[model samples]
Target chain A: MPEAPRTGELAPELSLPDLQGRATSIRDLRGRPVLVTFLRHAG
Target chain B: MKVRDRWDRWEEIGAAAVFVVFDDPDLIRRTMLTDLDVGALPFDVLVDRSRGTYTRWGLTRASWSTIWLDPNVYKTYARLLRSGARLRSAGTDVLQLGGDFVLGPDGRVVLSRPQQRDDRPPVGELLRAARGSVEGGG
Candidate 1:
């Protein structure tokens, strides 16, 4: 596993597809504080 | 439940809440529609089929013992079962762990909470951390 981004470090850019297959990136929400929660799995 | 409960507050604070799942989008959509009674989620739901996001975020895989032996896991399972949610054949990697992160407007991580068990960090704590980041501009 890669190192998790530490506080004060830039969040690694994430470009992933949403449920509707639309691509979304973390960089696009830069003007707002983003709370990103990673789930274990969809199940 | 935390995220869903505080959805409006998160938006009120000018924060976007995104959920990244390590599974295919179809499975996610199906599960959400069939098993959950909650209407559409208020925030974004991203699918990371390749688990690249997990690797990049340094999330570890839970050991078999960790999954089976944890009481919290059993409680959660029981609760879901009681709520009419049935266990299906696992389609994704069950061992993959999860975490929460609060990123500032500048794209820098403000808070990170890696799951130590089956549960996630409380939404209140996440909100507090986010509020602190916004107030302190740290």
Candidate 2:
């Protein structure tokens, strides 16, 4: 199990393909916090 | 916003971004056209393939009981349960449901929640959490 993030600790860097299949990476989200949601099929 | 309002408010928060990893191709199409008008969500909405992100994060929960122990997972489970969400898989498959995650720019996970079986995180709470990070207070 990956360790839950602690206060002041670096977050897990993630880079996943978006719905459009564009490469999105946490490393690219430097100036701001990134809110990533894993959603189920709502269609 | 009303608790039951089905609007996406991620666009309002400063630097607050929203990314939904949908495993279902059909859901991806629907979400794109859903017309969530709550707030200006400035983020990427994406589909997750290969289930790589779920596995890497170890977000697969063992049961509803186990989820309650983890606030992140429980929050999402409660929302789904309330919304009557169904999964593509059956029999204790955690990765098959909706999940929420809060990540810092440096790649640190601040909060992660699975879509609840009942209700999801209130827009107020989600905005508040994102606000904290935006102001560097979280």
Candidate 3:
């Protein structure tokens, strides 16, 4: 099946902390095309 | 099997940003530094220690029991639990969901792989889709 926030849906603006704990928001990448991968915890 | 080895293999087709969130931050950091197994995984490898992301996404351990409980699969934990006194007691099964989302410059999702079971993806396919998005096909 296809993923959520389907082809035409707008991605929710997420302001997550990077590895260094710096806040990075999705809106920050407003100009360049972005590829987002929601990954799982390595078990 | 060394999970990091597979990670090294995917590093070659660089373009799409790579990120890995691990349950154990200490273990991941130690293994990455000492073993140098995933030396070339160009992007940040972060921690999901509290499982905040898991719950937010509707991913649950119970949901994946069928996959891990299959008799044909050879999982170390399953085997170990089987030989114990409480052998048939079904153990906790964790489901790890992953996928790629191609977002346009406007922060809209154009393509996504919603049902992947693990973090690994076909490098060729991912790059192709990513390239297509960059070309405005998405």
Q: TM-score winner among the candidates? A: 1
- Write the residue-wise lDDT of candidate 2 on B1-138 in tens digits: 442252355445444465655445445455443565323334566555666666565444345564446676556567777889653332223325555567654555566665444235665665566666766655
**Residues forming the 10-long window of minimal summed lDDT in candidate 2 chain B:** B86-95
**Candidate 1 segments whose C-alpha is farther than 4 A from its true place:** B33-41, B83-85
lDDT of 1 by residue, B53-124 (tens): 878888788898998799988898899899997877665788888889999888889988777667787788
**Model 3 CA deviation exceeding 4 Å by range:** A1-3, B1-24, B31-41, B46-64, B70-93, B116-120
Candidate 3 docks at the CAPRI level of acceptable
Angstrom error of the Cα, residue A33, model 2: value is 2.5
TM-score of each model, in listed order: 0.88, 0.61, 0.60
Among the numbered candidates, top lDDT falls to 1
Q: Would you list the rank order by DockQ, best first?
A: 1, 2, 3
What are the chain A TM-scores for all the models, listed individually? 0.87, 0.64, 0.78
Q: TM-score winner between 1 and 3, please give it.
A: 1
Measured on C-alpha atoms, candidate 1 has an lDDT of: 0.81
Candidate 2: stretches off by over 4 Å? A1-8, B1-12, B31-42, B61-95, B114-119
Candidate 3 C-alpha lDDT tens digits along B72-109 = 34464566567682323221223655456667656667
